[model samples]
Target: MILPALLGLGTGLSLIVAIGAQNAFVLRQGIRRQHVLPVVLICGLTDALLEVLGVAGIGLVVERAPTLIEAIRWGGVLFLLWYAWGAVRRAMRPEALAAAQGSEASLKRTVLACLALTYLNPHVYLDTMVLMGSIGNAQGDPGRWWFALGGALASLGWFALLGYGARGLTRFFATPRSWQILEWCVAAIMVVIAARLAFGGIEV
Candidate 1:
């Protein structure tokens, strides 16, 4: 019971702590202090929902749908590369980056990007649906629900932390150079993750 939940919590955190595309996007939005609430809410809720469905045994269905996975894979790769290009441009043009600091992106655009990052990434489905689902189910009976609860809690907590906690770096990102470096780092992460997804298959 409690043991399954504890295991779920640990596993959930371990998988999410990595600096993937979604995490990178969250960090940037956090630091920029724009659309933070919606961004975090979308991320937190989506993760929780996915974990719930996964625990309910949707993972098996997902496992059988390689075509859906392939579609998501290509969509994610294109989106990531396109996003990486935006980051690269920001990095290269420090003046624009600095000027855009005080600017806020529209709520709709932010929500769309958040949703895309959450769903389009094939690895996310693999991790939450397949891997987490299988692990939760192995706990058996009511323990699986407990496991899902733990994982959902972890997901919500981590997103809240990442999206809100990023403000602490405000002082550092005050300069254009700092912003450039940050954008470049974000671009690198997007490209790397996109490359892995494009070439590494579900093993990623």
Candidate 2:
């Protein structure tokens, strides 16, 4: 049991620690000090929920429904492109990046964006539902539950660390130039992820 749990924890962290779209958004929000609690909550909870579904054998159902995946894929592509455009626009204007300096976003909008970042990306489904799910189920009945628990704990721990730990870099982002560079990085990440999703590639 302990072995399966530890295995799940290690595997879960390995998959999520990559600088994906969700992590990028969470980092930005953490640095901006905007709706950090809610954003992390949604991310952690959504990940746990997906893992549960996957472990419950829903992954099989979802796998058979390529149409649903395709719809989500396209939606994610459009949203990511739009977000990338915003980042590019901000990068072009240092003032726009500076606007986030000590700025706060509405809770509703922030939550919505967080949801979009969480759900629309096919990678999330592939990772949490399909990949994590398959791995957890392979642990066998009782062991699988322990595996899921480990994975869920990992999500919560990671998001909490990411969302809160980001403030440590607050001093660095004080400059407009720093914000511009950050926005450019975010834009690049979003564009690349969007392209990969469109092309049916999940990694990166």
TM-score of 1: 0.97
Model 1 worst lDDT run, 10 consecutive residues: 195-204
lDDT of model 1, residue 168: 97
lDDT of 2 by residue, 20-50 (tens): 8899999999998889999999999988899
- Least lDDT summed over 10 consecutive residues: which range in candidate 2? 195-204
Q: For each of the candidates, give the backbone clash count.
A: 0, 0
Model 1 lDDT at residue 194: 90
Q: How well does each candidate superpose onto the true structure, as a TM-score?
A: 0.97, 0.96
C-alpha lDDT of all candidate models, in order = 0.89, 0.89
Return the lDDT, model 2, position 111: 94
